[model samples]
Target: MNENLTIIWEKCLTFMRDNLNAAEDNTDLKKLENSFDLLFDNVQPVSLNNNNLTLLVPSDFYKEYIEDNYLSLLSAALKKNIGKGVKLWYSVMENKPAGQEKPITMNMKGKSVATPKMQETLPPSFSANVINPFVVPGMKKIHIDSNLKADFSFDNYVEGECNKFASTVAKSIAKRPGATAFNPLFLYGGYGVGKTHLGHAVGLEVKHAYPEKVVLYLSSEKFIQQFVSAAKAHKQTEFANFYQMVDVLIIDDIQFLSGKKSTQDSFFHIFDYLHQNGKQIILTSDKAPVDILDIQDRIVSRFKWGLSAEIKSPDFDTRRKIIVDKLSRDGIVLTEDMLDYLASEVKTNVRELIGVINSVIAYSTIYKSDLSLELLKETISKIAANQKKVINIPYIQDVVCEYFGIEREQLLSKTRKREIALPRQLAMYFAKEFTNATFNKIGEEMGGKDHSTVMYACDTIKDVSKIDKEIKKYVKELTEKIKQ
Candidate 1:
């Protein structure tokens, strides 16, 4: 029976290779097979009856992983080779022969750690033993609530020049906690620039790469709140001790810690303990430590102990890519012109950019409007709060000519044609409205008209806009265009 089972297992492996190789595009299947080789390959097939088979694995973790992730693939491969309707099952091997070696175990860091064959149940509290928590009688081990969000991972983080350096440092800290010079990664940036996202990503990555390592992520506000609660309950020492046990502690919005002298003193001690123990720390703040006001000098000094990386406001190209990425995720398509329009208009922070895109998508859905340039302009005009820029006479002239479908030279020419006359007058009016250029300066720039002509043009447009809806619409559209 053992020999037959071995033969069937070899055939199953061959079947897996053939099927998986044929579907090379199925990367998830390929990853499952890779995990199989890393985990299930060493398992011994103990029984086989025609299409029914059973294999013995070393630990519950291995059994659970195989059952959850690869059982379907393994069964499919076995059926392809053995016969239709073949079934497979796994059982834990509780006993081992003398002199047999224990199965190798890989930790979250992907490093092999030697574990004894026999398993033991541990309490909830953490301990000094890095590999295994030291057993304590009567006192339970601490349970660390990491408070990290799973969705905020490094994989989904969009990397660009504005945050590449900070992302790199975050990834390094994730790989080897407290091993690099960046023992504590201090990330400072404007709100919505992805500092909180990056902080969460670092914690999640560290937890993934080192499952045994304790990770805790909390906002500075929450930290202060917790400290206050603990102090009120007279459990401050317990609070401090619990934090000291975490391998990686992520605190967001450290700027809020200002003016909280007691919280600062408590955190200073926790920071010192964790740093001295070679644990990793991550902090997010709106400003750098030196610029943080009302904070103790010693606390600020500790913040400056590690590398400080800043995430600046994304540039035009980066913002463009961000909008494209967002639209792609929502399966929405926009023309290059529309994308450029959005990227140009929303040049603030990432949060606001995403908010603007969401607003546009929502408006399109509710209004049942196709994503035309006109719809885009109207939506932007409605939603963009910070889209204003300093205006100039040249910009006004350009908008006027573009709106009337004429040339700058024609608008500025001596022609008295109604088409040219109206747009030229509108340009002079906007030049007076939007720019600091005096009437003389505006007239001198526009076909060398007299200052009185500029004044008369402004009055004519303003009066017509009051009673003429067509003129009002034109003025509104031109105003929105110029602002955008």
Candidate 2:
């Protein structure tokens, strides 16, 4: 009975798919196909005839839900396969097959079987809806969902000057996907700079807008791991086949693929196949394509074929805006002064800024304390200490000179005029504080002044900044600029 039922079920599915494809859809046809697949893959026919066709589902919920939402479509498709006179009946199975370690379904031979847990360990084979494992040959179609993150949508992504262009392009790609010229949108930036966020945002947006499209976001490490597993299982062809069917493939941190020659070689073919077929590919890395080490020139050439956008550290204003948005979402109200303090102090990346925010908010809730500047300072001080600080003396000089509207040479000269002298001293102070240079080196770098003069200049700025708010403000602004 199961053998005959399986054959009839396969016939009905083929008929329905061909019929649906012929009609233009207001509904997502792929989604409907997936719903059909889920039912057919897990459920089986108990009996069939011209007058009535009865099916056995795994549980009562499955029976009822399928009858309510999918009965009409299934009935229509069945009529086309059997006849319009046939009535469809669905009921829960009285007993699951015995001696089964996993969910059991009837294979084509009328024998109950379970997909090996080992096979399930492999990455999902291509399908339209959920993460389903590949079944034995001549069985019903199974679908595994694209592993996109639900929370990583565009609505939550905070836009700033640093990532505006990249965000805009990502949105455009999401709307059109492979139809756009930015087929392989490469996003590169240092840690915590929104590259991964933007990559996931694009995939989520694509899945939301185009339900029929298969969008997969994977880290290069995971991809390599899967490829190695597939090769070990001798299912390399199946692995290649699965990825080839994806509509959009997003690989995060492609730098991780460096030094893995076999993984890179396999990915190169997959990359070529997808690109030639008009599929969209998005990649993220810590560095630009050219800067990525140990990668093949051919693979790097393909990455360069599309757009490469870099997300830099957010400027102080952008960082402040991000904090305001994040706090507003968390229902935490903080003053502008407090926000500015965070923006200026946590000057490295968005992730660290957000980490500090979460920590402080969690601490406040546990202690029943209002969020305050003191709590923020305490939270950020610990985080900032752990973070590696970047020191650039030339950048500091440029910022100081720009603030005073003096020539670069004037900032480095021996002139004692008040304007030049003050700016020069400010430059010296920043060089000593920010860089690893010795006092002698700082003095030599700044107008060939002696070590004592550099020390005096640092002392004078420190004393004046304490007494003058404007001077303090200048130092703070200059420090922030240099950090950025």
Candidate 3:
């Protein structure tokens, strides 16, 4: 009977491959086979009892993953290979928590709770072992909600020339976490360039594959806030210890650690321990490791130990694919010309591209208007006009410097004189206003100024603009000129 089950499972796998790989594309066939290897190769045939086929799985995570992701496929395969109305059962070989082993049975009936549409998405239980190393008291094991959204899967991500290299590297790292040379994979690019999305995607991939491994995704700003909280609560060692226990650590916007000495020191220790122990560490930043200012040299040097891939703004073809993928997922179809028109008009980044698509769809639905190239052109132009300017850091600096009758270098100087200080502040103000740069980034443009320093400068400018009429005039006039 067990031998029969083996033959049945093999036939099922073959059937699956044939069904999924019917396409002539070698790449698609290879991908289907690869997914089969990861998902089904480990599934061992245990026994066949009275219309129920029990399969032995490695872990409970493995069972849940198969059920959530491939239950439909597996069930159909069994019906085709075995017989109708034969259900599948899961027997975990090693279901242990804190050294206690137990057996778990999962009977996936046709009436399972999860809908078919969500089968492709991961279950929240993927974040089973995630715990906040900080803020949780007393218990060595603490629970923290994972920010890695299941919606941020690679299936949802659009692969383009700009991100193809990074995407490939990230998938490789996910398949072989901590063992790959892409340890501490550094992704850098402008805002809305999908850096954070890719980072979350990598974390989700690792979690889906290695559910037993602890994977946590926290932004650097949140890391700093937690560090501050941990310091005040006097649980610094506990915090560090908790983090060191993570098998895969993903930190976004590592540039936010700039100019922060103690946070850098703490993170450096954690990073060194994980790297030495062959655990994976992935970091995302707006700037590359070398360009990240004020971080400790040791930390910066370690960031270079692995791959550094940049995902720039999507190209024209990439943008078009993004639009198609996004709208198709939502089950909304537009004419190819409308898609191409939006693709050409919104060239900033994926975030804006999707935002433009959403706006267009909303307009069409609300006004009951048919999609047209002219309407898309009008809508995108209004968005551009609303932005008021095509301003970046350099452009803001140029406008502010020229307005103040000072050289561009004056605003970038380390030592701010009374004369140059206001101009510098205005530049930061305009940068904050006209660009999507973070405060720390604006500070970097203004010569290594810290986050708080940038906030103070912006505040001072706002206050002075209210009461000081001349400063107010400067703000109003510079704002218009920059918009121009």
Which pairs of residues collide in model 2? 130-144, 130-145, 131-144, 131-145
Model 2, range 20-137, lDDT digits (tens) per residue? 6665663545445545666567777777765677777765435534544466667787877777777666544533445744333331113223222111122344332322223343
State which candidate, 1 or 3, has the greater TM-score.
3
Candidate 3 Cα lDDT to native: 0.76
TM-score of 3: 0.58
lDDT of each: 0.75, 0.74, 0.76
Model 3 Cα lDDT, one tens digit per residue, 204-242:
988888888888889898899988887787656656776
Model 1 stretches with alpha carbons more than 4 Å out? 1-142, 367-369, 385-484
Question: Which numbered prediction scores highest in lDDT against the true structure?
Answer: 3
Worst 10 residues of 1 by lDDT: 128-137
The number of the candidate with the highest TM-score is 3
**If scored against the real structure, what TM-score would every candidate get?**
0.52, 0.53, 0.58
Better of 1 and 3 by lDDT: 3
Q: Which parts of model 3 are misplaced by more than 4 Å?
A: 1-24, 28-141, 385-390, 394-443, 446-484
Ranking of predictions according to lDDT: 3, 1, 2
Q: Name the better of 1 and 2 by lDDT.
A: 1
- Supply the TM-score for candidate 2: 0.53
10 residues in a row with least lDDT, candidate 3: 114-123
